[model samples]
Target: MAIESVVVRQRVEDLDAAVPFYEKLTGSTASRFAFAGVDLAGVGPFLLFAGSDEAVQRVAGVAATLVAADLDAAVEAATAAGAEVVMPVQPTPNGRRAVLRHPHGGVFEYVGPS
Candidate 1:
């Protein structure tokens, strides 16, 4: 399967403060989305969010959320490759996604547009 793109997700304590800094740093306006008590902004390949770190820890740190053309197939492939599902495949406010942990304990998210 071809990997489309990887997005790095970071959790911050404050959305209001984080957005402007990233907006200036990336030189682009952020596309906003809210889900599960978190506010998210996409700045290029970086997905910055304001939420609890503990909640974000379910997926691990600085790991890329891999975008797939076929999310279900991606999950199946990941599972077959020895990646444990951290978050099961499900439809979110934004899309269909799941988090998988590599054998080495690194975590990554696989997502597709709903």
Candidate 2:
């Protein structure tokens, strides 16, 4: 998989509550989207997320979201490199996503159209 941009995900207590701070921090207004019932806003290179404890926990510690040219290939490459799949490939607003924990214990999300 050809890696592209990486987006960082930040957990927040409240979506609306967090927007202005991030807007000022990034110098860019956020574009909102929902994922698995979680309210998310794309603010610059960061994905600010807010939701239930369970939902937040589900994605917690995913240090970065890696964009790729091909989602399947990315998953394959990750698995082949001994990364454990935290979640199988799934649909998202931008494309498909899969979370993985590398053998060394680093966590990340991979995304791409296909």
Candidate 3:
């Protein structure tokens, strides 16, 4: 499976305030989006998010989001390598995603075509 890009996840209290800083830091305009009632902004390789406590908690354990070339193949490979699925494949604003916890215990979210 080809790993496209790794997005560093940041949980912020206010997206409006955070977007500018991230955009400035990354030198890329923020791509605004939302999912599950949470506001999200993609600035370069960073993803900034802010929302209700429930939404925040839902993704709190995920250390990073990895863009995959094939979600199914990535999921299969991860599980085969001993990664446990924390969340099953689901549709996201951008594509489909699944959360997995690695054998060493870091949770990661993988995104790919729906």
Candidate 4:
């Protein structure tokens, strides 16, 4: 068996504020969608949404994780694009990784084999 990909979904309070930051961070434009009264933006493996606080709370602290080819470069790019470091890049028992918060509030982790 094989797993294809993962999509981490987050709910935001403001869709407008979320889109630009994600677009910049991912270096990809958001493809918008409407699902269950929420506005969504497909940012790489993340599905960022804007809706009620109650719904948003459901996924709090859950982050989208990606395996990067160049962990340092990825962290630099994310920072340059406006993401704040949630956890500084460091080596773990498993590998090297960094956690960042998108300007819109969604968190993500970038990991790479070292």
Candidate 5:
């Protein structure tokens, strides 16, 4: 499966405040969405998140969320490559997601709509 893109997560107090800056920077409109009570949007490679402390903490310090056409393959490959699955594949509102810790100690989330 080909990796689609890496989306950087950033917590913000206000989605309105974040959108304008990211829009100018990416030169693209943000598509709004919600996941587990958290406000989510994408501008270029950035995934802006705004919500409560608990909601924001879920994705905080994630470093990045990797998107791929085939999340199953991605998870399988990660396991084969020696990464431990910290969060098993699970259904989300839009798709599936999982967290992994690489052999080198870096952690990241992989997500996609299967």
Candidate 6:
């Protein structure tokens, strides 16, 4: 599957406060959204998220989120490449996603249309 975009993850204590800095840096308006009880802001290639300890911890440790043309294909390619499934495919705000841990230990989340 083709990778459409990549978003860097930033876990912040306050999403509202963090959004302004990224907006200025990227010269783009932040698109606000919420998922699994976490508040998120997308500014350019950065994704800033903030929420309660429990909520934030649920999404912690994911280094980046990638938009894939096909989530199932992405997962299959990842597994064939020696990646382990950390989180199975599941529904997300915009689509579905799955988390995979590479053989080298980097964790990545892939998202695509539902």
Look at candidate 1 and tell me the lDDT of residue 114: 78
- Candidate closer to the true structure by TM-score (higher is better), 1 or 6: 6
Per-residue alpha-carbon lDDT of candidate 5 for residues 1-114, written as tens digits (9 for 90 to 100)? 667989888888899898999999999999889987889988888999998888788788577999989999998998998999999999987689999999998889999995
Pairs that collide, model 3:
none
What pairs collide in candidate 4? none
When 2 and 6 are scored with lDDT, the better candidate is 6
* Ranking 3 against 4 by lDDT, winner: 3
Model 6 error, position 91 (Å) = 1.4
Candidate 5: deviation at residue 95, Å? 2.1
Question: 1-114 in candidate 6: lDDT tens per residue?
Answer: 778999999999878788999999999999999998889888999989999989988777898998998899999998998999999999977789999999999999999999
> Ten-residue segment with the worst summed lDDT in candidate 5?
54-63
User: lDDT at 44 for candidate 4?
Assistant: 72
Off by over 4 Å in 1: 52-62
List the candidate 4 regions with Cα displacement exceeding 4 Å. 1-60
TM-score, every prediction: 0.83, 0.86, 0.93, 0.48, 0.89, 0.90
Q: By TM-score, highest first, what's the ranking? A: 3, 6, 5, 2, 1, 4
What is the C-alpha local distance difference test score of candidate 5? 0.89
Model 3 per-residue lDDT tens digits across residues 8-114: 99999989988888888889999999887788898999988889998777776789998998999999999999999989999988889999999999999999997
Model 2 per-residue lDDT tens digits across residues 6-85: 99889999889999998999899999988777889989988999999888777777889998988899889889989999
lDDT (tens digit, per residue) of candidate 4 on 7-109: 6766667888988888888898888865435566777776787777665543346576666767888888888989899878887544687778888897876
User: Against the unseen true structure, what C-alpha lDDT does each candidate score?
Assistant: 0.81, 0.88, 0.90, 0.71, 0.89, 0.91
Please give the lDDT score for candidate 1: 0.81
